[model samples]
Target chain A: MVDRPGGNPRAAVVGTGLIGGSVLLRLHRRGLDVTGWDPDTATRAEGRARGIPFPDELADAVRDRDVVFLCGPLSSLPETLLTVAKHTGPDCVLTDVGSTKGGIAGFAAAHGLSDRFVPGHPMAGAERAGLTAAVPDLFDGAAWVLCPAATGIERFRTLAALVIDVFGARVVPMAPDAHDAAAALASHIPHLLAGSLAGAVADADLRDAVLGLAAGSFRDGTRVAGTPAVRTADMLLNNRDQVLAQLGRVTGLLDRLAAALRAGDAVALVGHYQRARELRLALLDRELPPVVRDFPLGGDSDDELAYLLSLGAAGGHLTGCRVAAGTVTYTGHLSTAPA
Target chain B: MVDRPGGNPRAAVVGTGLIGGSVLLRLHRRGLDVTGWDPDTATRAEGRARGIPFPDELADAVRDRDVVFLCGPLSSLPETLLTVAKHTGPDCVLTDVGSTKGGIAGFAAAHGLSDRFVPGHPMAGAERAGLTAAVPDLFDGAAWVLCPAATGIERFRTLAALVIDVFGARVVPMAPDAHDAAAALASHIPHLLAGSLAGAVADADLRDAVLGLAAGSFRDGTRVAGTPAVRTADMLLNNRDQVLAQLGRVTGLLDRLAAALRAGDAVALVGHYQRARELRLALLDRELPPVVRDFPLGGDSDDELAYLLSLGAAGGHLTGCRVAAGTVTYTGHLSTAPA
Candidate 1:
């Protein structure tokens, strides 16, 4: 196992919601010394019930942590970061799991915390939210974009590497503005389209027949329409300009399709469909970096050996090993990282 | 089992592609005397290899059949129906599994075959097409709309009932025009939206990152984008007006969302999402009619009895029973239709 660069670094996660709770759980499972805090008493209690060390006071949670993660609702992230900055150690790095990076980056700059902050967004989520929905493997194999502050490249890179090493997430670094623009096109606009599509069938008269005959294509196409309104609104409003730009482009495409249908232009319709099919197939074949991690083997018993063999069978390559006392520490690479 | 109303009805299915091959295979499994014909030699050969009876000539295939099903591409359906009308027996009922009904219905009417033609559309499909992609249970639990000819409702009903009884499909009858409009909203426009959404991401600069970070929402939202262009184009062009209308509605909804995002109107955005979520959840909870089928018991041995018991445990109700020598004739209702 690669020893953590600065010994056993202490970490604290604020919010204890889905993203925050998941980060805390995954870090704790990887043997990191971590604590959590949430403004909501019930949420903090739930996190503690899940075996996460939770401090009732936010200040206590952040006092001496080497890294502090602010993961809360997008609207409240700036305020939460301000509070975290006050209590965290001077040398501690700060980061977030917010959906949009531009606003958070701006807030860090306004507060003169830019050098200590790295804005991040894990491109993964479930329809459900909150502490109960957190899972250790939530970020596994997912794209976790890290927009490091220009002034603190080294500090940001170190913290990013530590997080990626523990979560087994593929980290892609991009400028905050570029990341917001790309996310608008890739995520936000698609979500809005799903909601609009669902809204099209909301008419009382058409609801029954449309719902009754709806099959896989409709259901799959509109799955994101079920995302809660508050979350969707926060995303769209936060990334307003980029989301609006994407919506314009999509609107243009939809218009062309409508014109083709109106004119009964089969060739034009076929051209659009062919282009889309080719692009979608290309996406399905796109490859990403493999996930590799250091698994701390607890013992050399039969069950432990069998478990190690099973991991190898699952396309994990054993890279290095260390034998200390009765424990065997094995570092390996994993294929097909969990979602 | 429900005795064939017309006594051992013979059937001929044209095209022998995915839908046609599936229909042929399923009817053959139900002990119907069926034959198939396809213009494409390889497709016909594949169907034949799967043990479906195939006649070398279209005329021979339709000569003595009680019914003929045209299951070719939507663009070629009109011509195929015209040819079938010329070759089929005088009393034979004609039907089709085309996605768009208006054009085929008009063609049948113009050819003076309205008395024998039933326009049908089975709302089930896979991204893959042709005989190689055919599955016998493709129609089970799917909505199969039948638009009967104005002149021969009784004949059309009989044929639709037979198709549903054997395939265990939910058969909903509607006027040809109404069916076209409903399908535009429920299926055609959704496919177009998927393609358009995919088209939005086809820009060269955005392709790599968009593809890399796309999660479940984007993947599911654009799944139908991978459907073959020719088929999608055919459906859009054939039902031009209705598809155009639905596209207009969807475009308006998208425009409202774009305006809300541009204005930073969180409340408006939330309203749209809440409406969509409510509609989607309601759709998930909507109930449909139970699948009832007559499953024929094949034998009276221990294994056969075990199989019968298993069927019963799966929600099939014993409807009738008869015994002659060692063979047993038992009919039961199947609870869950296979698809």
Candidate 2:
């Protein structure tokens, strides 16, 4: 790791899983001294094993630390931030790595610590989390959105620049309300949509079949559904208003498209695809530096039905194997028996 | 190799890439004498290089083959099927692994090949394609959807059973319309959305920035957009009606949610997410057997943007060194990247 430049203040990151671990790695690579905290002992141990120092107490982690980064679940942010606020140094800054900002900002204000808090989100993560999952190059060239909570302009700019310097991420300053709304459209709603889709096909047998047939389309569409349940519930419950608003827009889009199809209006239908295409492209153009994903591949797996989860094995021939009487024998290694 | 029980029907797979190559793998594994063909000489040569013999012509491939599989671009399917229909043996059964069925089925009937054609879709494939990219285990437990013409019940069923035995996939039969509509929703529309998103961010600079901060949410939201341009255009152009219909539905959903946000209708917004969650869950529960995925890392990648552009990067993840600094360094023993 590069040595931090003179006057570069240290930052404390709480909950060193995917998000926190990534923040820690990015901060460290950019030469910022980072101290991490995770309630999960194993997760903390893993972080320690990876050579990232872990603080046992919230106060110990944040005290005198130039900035405190709350990189935990959305639901946990309010209480944890509140707890941090109680013991924080008045001059020290505080921020969060939560996806939804409005609710957390509100929580900060309710606890009378709004001036010290600046909510931010780095729009990046992978399918894995934890300290061992940490990589120093996590946030290079990503968009780190900051939603200041009535914090002074100097403080916000300082925090934002610090993020840019430490994570190599661009700073996009947004109001907490706007941040929540934007995230509802871009992130929260998508998660809820995926969860809903997963919930809809709750049938074990159907899930087994679906998982096999689930190509990129299904996988992409339902990826967010794999986020831990606690995070899902936190975002759903905390940013209820913004998420609901975004959901309404999505449903509206679905209805319009469905109506066009029902009406047999091919022109109208194509227009919708074109519009969606444009919107999606616009969203994608806003690149984010890669980071370890906060969410794990969620849901209970059926070990018995695991045999049924075939991937891309159709309409193609299998090499080194032949089938006879409905069983396959292969020349190369076989991972598992067919369901 | 498993012995082909008494006269295991000979089969032919045309267009040996992704779907076609995979079809060959499964069939060969099942002990069928599988012949392969592709218009691209290099692809055919790669198959040959890999010990997968490629027939010089379609007729040469399927002359005595009991089952003929057409696995090519959607636009090419009609013409290819027409050519095959003229020379295919009267007893030979013909099936296609196209994304859309309505157009192909319509084209077959127009070409006087209706009775011989059974439209099918193997719900699988990577953003990557080609014979060299083929895997023997591509369709082990995915869904192989078949849309049989009215008079070809027995032939379709036999083909379906063969698919099951070969790929270890579930044979799901549905009316062509249902299959087409569902494909439009699950596959076609998603592709269009991804492309649209990619298109919006076509600006190289923005793409670079957005990609760095990009997390799984954006990647999943835009995964299908990485589909090849020709194939993407063909899918949209051929299934224009269904794709357009679905686009309208999605746009409507977007609009409604936008309006709800404007109106601050928290209740409506939450309801929408709840409903979408249900739909996603329902999708997850459905069992589709015989599909296979070749990616061992499950789609996370360090150079995903480059990979999506068809750069061969070992499927996912960077094993050693940083691409950020413009050099490919091997820190440890590295396997050659996937072709």
Candidate 3:
């Protein structure tokens, strides 16, 4: 209906999980002749039951497909790609939807399909997994990172773009190693660290008490930890080097933060806060070089007041009040500002 | 109609903001004769206009009140307490709802009124702050932590239990220093870290991108940072020592984690994941300990299955299509062996 851009292109999507299925939906909606395959027949049957066309045989599914999307566990992608290459059309463009790249790219090169494969990762997912959880809008506004295969195929690159665009995602071109590194810091290592933090406190009673008091902080810090173990395990096993490298950098940062705390340098602590605040604000507004805007509180209350007042003291004015049991709180907006 | 437990005990609530208002509402609903006072007349007027009784004067508010609740910035607690002591009934049990405890406990000891003040913190709030934002169930299903003041009266502790019970919150008794340390680790330092992390990413594009990419992780990490500066500043300034101490511990843990990552020990990385898994799981069921259960992924995944087996293998599930781009997800359960 949407012009079916990749129409009549024989497409093979291996793995009918959330990402893979969603990609299939996008490609199918774009009018590409699509076929779904998975090692698990029951899962295939489940997909077929949902009215999605799933061919019985893997070879039949990929025989004429012009493009193949290797979307599954990172650990399985290597073998799956080899399997697909053996059966897919000679001119087929192969790509993957794994989060990391360097290793996968190496694997593709070793498999002699470097020219036909493009490594990509769509930075989109919910805590929930599986094809049943797939939604059309999942990738809409999500970033689809493409890492060109070492032996480049311009047509394959173009195909990669179509794959990304078809899914309503923006294509971000990056080198395989670079992409892996970026993901290590931005996603993989963060996930591991979140899981580790959650693991740090393992006592049952203490854990419950801590969780009971757990508000947003715990939630944010450990969000990626909720990913299914199978997926996480694949990422960890496949992208070990880059993840470790990024962990090194983060550890250095953590060390400095710790030293600052131990030193009782209020100024340094505030500096950290300022840095974090500036980065957050810039990210919120998409400011390039990262800037911090300074505004002053009208009265000489304190630096905190100054910052609050400077942040455009709007209808949400600061009112100082003490609640039940003498817990003091600053509440409300100013009369000059609209509520 | 509920036995108005607050009637004869003229209640003086310092810092008449959100928490204070909620406490007042519960007290009022319980038939307590409550009076509120704030440095800002408008806040007091707003409370009064909203049907919360406001005292003619601070001294008059606590003169005959049997219980007094100090609700304000942790930094201002000492000064407020000193002032309250000057006008408080000798028999009055003074308590507060500050997040930190050691300082408040010290304040009472230093001010020669150790027997009357009970320190408490309600683990509940919202991004919106004001008298108008106050709601009755603010403390529902929340934790009401009590740090018994050195000079606290037994009746004061009983009164606190009576008051917090109305909100459906389970009262947890803890020591002043312990409570301060716990809050520092669980809440204060996390906020500081989140703010600092957000501020560190100075790239405007990256900032927004980060925010956009922020699924559950960044939101949970920076959740507390989204609150008002007044509360943040107060927590930092008041609980400086304890917060710093906890930060030291967190830094140490993070250092070890970083080292594990840098060493590129897959085993160590896996160990971290395993530990995190145990900790996270421990936090879910209420029957577990409070320490390790600091954060819980409250969402239930009933229909989800981890597609881990090979094609045609037992329990194997497929996700995407082979011929067309479609998904088939497995709806089964993971083997319930503890990770």
What local lDDT does model 3 show for residue B241?
79
Q: lDDT at B88 for candidate 3?
A: 74
Every model's DockQ, to 2 decimals?
0.32, 0.09, 0.14
- What lDDT tens digits, residue by residue, belong to model 3 across residues B275-305? 6666565444334221210111123221111
TM-score of 2: 0.60
Cand. 3: chain B TM-score: 0.77
lDDT of each: 0.74, 0.59, 0.59
> What TM-scores do the predictions have?
0.81, 0.60, 0.71
Residues A145-197, candidate 1: write the lDDT tens digits.
77654476545445656656788776655567877877887788888888888
Interface RMSD of each: 7.3, 12.4, 10.1
In Å, residue B298's CA in model 3 sits off its true spot by 41
Give candidate 2 regions above 4 Å deviation: A1-68, A71-83, A91-93, A100-118, A122-214, A225-339, B1-5, B25-31, B106-115, B203-209, B246-248, B285-339
Q: In candidate 3, what are the lDDT values of residues A248-305, reduced to their tens digit?
A: 5555554565566566555665665555554444334432221232323223324433
Full candidate order by DockQ, most accurate first: 1, 3, 2
* Fraction of the reference Cα-Cα interface contacts (below 8 Å) that each candidate reproduces: 0.68, 0.18, 0.26
